[model samples]
Target: MTEETHLNPTQPVNQQIYRILRRDIVHCLIPPGTPLSEKEVSLRFDVSRQPVREAFIKLAENGLIQIRPQRGSYVNKISLNQVRSGGFVREAIERAVVRRAAILVTDAQLYQLEQNLNQQRTAIDRHQLNDFFQLDDDFHQILCDIAQCRLAWETIENIKAAMDRVRFMSLDHVTPHEMLLEQHWAIFRALEKHDEQLADETMHQHLAEISASVLLIRQENRDWFTEEQ
Candidate 1:
């Protein structure tokens, strides 16, 4: 595993470590089934073992790692069931959110969506994959907010961790970011026109791509997935 580049002294050490490890795991930098050592991670980050242990606990809670009593902690392989379950929840909530957003969105909120799309284009042009991914998330989040369903967005966040890992793996391999951007545009248009049916259909199509990508990725990286999947 690569050492974290820098740590902010002001922030909580465990949270920082958790975020770094989470990003690496999600991006497949630390491949599935690789053992993690508290000692090594602590030394690498120049922090104490306590923070590393705390970080591991958080990672395990997020389904990114498996902690064995005596064996060791290892990055958990992707579960196909979790991916499907997450996708189902995401689609159900987002479809409804978009439908309501189509009816409730205002001109200012529409402009915000436009600005987000412009930033996404800039991120793509600059080859900033991470930035593009964040923007993509923000786009859907904004729609949820516009629909006055902040609670729904919170639920989606909790359930989408598995789908997020799949998305990270899909980037630059199974799907192009531009294609995702286009889908966002379609959804944006639907909201602009206040077409609930169109919004619902577009949201469904957009999220369905994740399932297709998961199938392709599983074939390519079999070891990264669980046997039970």
Candidate 2:
């Protein structure tokens, strides 16, 4: 709602609603445990409740919300176990993906990646946290593209919801944007040299950063996380 004033009529209404709600949830703009209502959301988006209901189903599937019959729906608190588990899986998949990219990446692909890095730097300079967040994901996605593993990135997107919440928080509190940009550069350099091992290692280290920051972030914002695990 805060990010986009209006949903594009050209896109599927349900998809746009799902993405906007997901972005709001991940950014903690709506915060954890906040109640959600189909009627309210439909009113907010000025669309029919059917698309809002469809969007809620997708959010629940991603573990971003809980829908209770009669009880109503609410955003789910961040799960430490889910976040760590998701990170482990993502790191394994991405490590392999980056290694493969190093071997297969062409000069043109490297140039494209360089342009992405430049855009990342610009985002950082402009203090555009959201833009930088998207660009960071784009950099990793580009590597997956170079490796010819679109499925790998798709799988990551499905599993990374909890990880994404922490990632957004860490950008402000734990990991500095400059440090992240440097890590991106390191991974880019390894790909440029076709150093598969270095690429694998850098990707591992880069992804491992979130694991190190999650605890501190939880401490700073205790209510955002669940205590069960």
Candidate 3:
């Protein structure tokens, strides 16, 4: 993965830091539960400890990291709560989004989605995990564009960040990968017919399994997930 480029000054420093770090963490470029030292980050970024500290504080606010009083910062363990909440929110938005996309989606857009799906197939065949994951992200974002609610796509993105690590971890599972491709086909068909209800239902069904998917990860990497229920 490329280094996260921090955005310019319209936003707060901590916010920029949080966003950059969040992306890296979600992508598993930085391993989960890995310790993060503010001093180290400060030196790396050529910033003060305060900004780095502030950044960690913001990540803490987002539950993306944990800080101990004397000990250094560390990536937080995988959160079942983030998975549950993100899945819930995605279901609600995608229900509306897929339905709307069905009505508004043009043939061109549908073709584009098909092309995107084709790349996903290629990624699978080539065993290119990064490319597959990137295509998967593009597919969903493009669907949200079809719905014409760009901000809804942004909301979907923020929610995705929380569940992404779990996704990255389990994405190697062949059955789910094949199942996801099939689900995309179903969604594409429902959208093509402008069948809002069918599209909505299909999208919900797609997101609703996220919790179960994470549970599979929980079983394999008990250390990565939360200890609580």
lDDT of all predictions, in order shown? 0.89, 0.92, 0.80
Query: What are the per-model numbers of colliding residue pairs?
Result: 0, 0, 0
- Ranking 1 against 2 by TM-score, winner: 2
Candidate 2 TM-score, true structure as reference: 0.96
Candidate 1 lDDT for residue 61? 74
What does the lDDT read for residue 67 in candidate 1? 90
How many clashing pairs in candidate 3?
0
lDDT per residue as tens, model 2, 27-75: 8798888999999898888999999999999999888999999999999
Runs with alpha carbons beyond 4 Å of true place in candidate 3: 1-20, 45-58, 68-71, 227-229
Root-mean-square deviation of each candidate, in angstroms? 2.1, 1.3, 3.3
Candidate numbers sorted by lDDT from highest down: 2, 1, 3
Lowest lDDT 10-residue stretch of candidate 1: 220-229
TM-scores vs. true structure, each candidate: 0.90, 0.96, 0.82
The true-versus-predicted C-alpha distance at residue 161 of model 2, in Å, is: 0.8
Comparing 1 and 2 on lDDT, the stronger one: 2
TM-score of structure candidate 1: 0.90
Model 1, residue 179: what's the lDDT? 94
Model 1 alpha-carbon miss at residue 170, Å: 1.7
